[model samples]
Target: MNNLKREFDASTVAMMRQAMNEVVADRRFLICQSVTPLEVAEHILEQAASGERDLDRLKISVFEKLSDAA
Candidate 1:
């Protein structure tokens, strides 16, 4: 999420924010606590950078990546 960052238009940013929030909520639900690991956000940002625009797909990809990492 460092140098990979690039400017996105307002709507894209909003979608990413919505996806991030949903991802966080889903993660919390899975573990039953208010915990959001930095890697989760980082991974989602990376996925967004990689041209993933769909909110649901972005979230599922994050969970899939996290599960693979675990």
Candidate 2:
């Protein structure tokens, strides 16, 4: 239903936002301004979709991605 779809969308957005905040607050990510927090957030969401929901793991995954980029 449309309502179910809307709810899913809302939850996804909330998750992404929370991930973004966590990434931004991380000391490892605080010094980097080249990549947008949104990009990192998307990466986190992708990892979560792939069944990795643990915050620490997500943070490490994002950190590694950014490290590789740099």
Candidate 3:
């Protein structure tokens, strides 16, 4: 039983580390994109102005969906 618990804990830790690495890689890729953050922010603001409600709320919802997939 102790061995099983140890193995499960190790596996969970490894998965968490891999997820962290993937997030870092994704951020790097986004930063490398030609589009700047200001441009994206402006777009989001436009979207909000067009009756999209709170822009930050939408962003959080989208990110949560993506995180679930990961």
Candidate 4:
């Protein structure tokens, strides 16, 4: 039982470390862009929440806005 607990703990720690690495990598990408990382992340979350992640939908929306502006 103690051994199993240790294994689980080790697995959890490794998973957390990998997740941290991914976040750091994402931060690096975010830093290169014009928008802040937090804003980008929030937009991603909002898109997921709204189920509006389709690329075609985003493209059409942008095009519509541009046409309306013209």
Candidate 5:
């Protein structure tokens, strides 16, 4: 049970890291260094929490959030 939980946690972290990298690699996002990578990661996590696993949707949502912030 403990091993399963650990595995799940590790996978979740890896998924988030991949998502964050995708967000950072986006051309629109790259032009906005003021937003910070961590902030974009948080946005991605937030969308994931809401059951949004679609990568394109996550990217669009993150971009919308950044635009609103700007």
Candidate 6:
């Protein structure tokens, strides 16, 4: 599903929350000066927009984006 052009539904939202929670739980993700919850959420939405439906992948993508931003 190409969520890039559509509004995210409830399940997609739930997944993003779960993924964000997991990402923030990590100490490594917390110390990054450029990585904020809002930033992570935006990246999660970007991942979803790219058609990534897995929670793990969302978390991973957020991490990767953070790393790149660092």
- Backbone clash numbers for all candidates listed: 0, 0, 0, 0, 0, 0
TM-scores for the candidates: 0.74, 0.65, 0.34, 0.30, 0.66, 0.79
lDDT of 3 by residue, 1-70 (tens): 1122222245444543444344334664254445444544444444344444543454553344344434
TM-score of 5: 0.66
Candidate with maximal TM-score: 6
Name the better of 2 and 3 by lDDT.
2
Write down the lDDT of every candidate, Cα atoms only: 0.73, 0.70, 0.42, 0.40, 0.70, 0.81
For model 5, residues 1-70, the per-residue Cα lDDT tens digits are: 1122222255556666777888788887878767988888767776666666666677788888778767
Per the 3 Å backbone cut-off, how many clashing residue pairs does candidate 4 have? 0
lDDT of predicted model 4: 0.40
Candidate ranking (TM-score, best to worst): 6, 1, 5, 2, 3, 4
List residue ranges in candidate 2 displaced over 4 A.
1-17
Better of 3 and 4 by TM-score: 3
Winner on TM-score between 1 and 3 is 1
Choose the strongest candidate by lDDT: 6
After superposing candidate 1 on the true structure, give the runs of residues whose Cα lies further than 4 Å from its correct spot.
1-5, 27-36
- 4 versus 6: better lDDT goes to: 6
How large is the C-alpha RMSD of every model relative to the true structure?
3.0, 5.4, 16.5, 13.7, 5.8, 3.4
Which of the two, 4 or 5, has more lDDT? 5
Candidate 1, residues 2-67, lDDT tens digits: the string is 785487778878988897778766744367333356777777778878888888898788777766
* Shift in Å, residue 64, candidate 3: 15
Task: Enumerate residue pairs that collide in model 5.
Answer: none
Model 6 spans > 4 angstroms off: 1-5
Q: Candidates ranked by lDDT, best first? A: 6, 1, 5, 2, 3, 4
Q: After aligning candidate 3 to the native by TM-score, how far in Å is the CA of 17 from where it should be?
A: 28
Candidate 4 lDDT over 13-43, as tens digits, reads 4543443344436534434444443543444
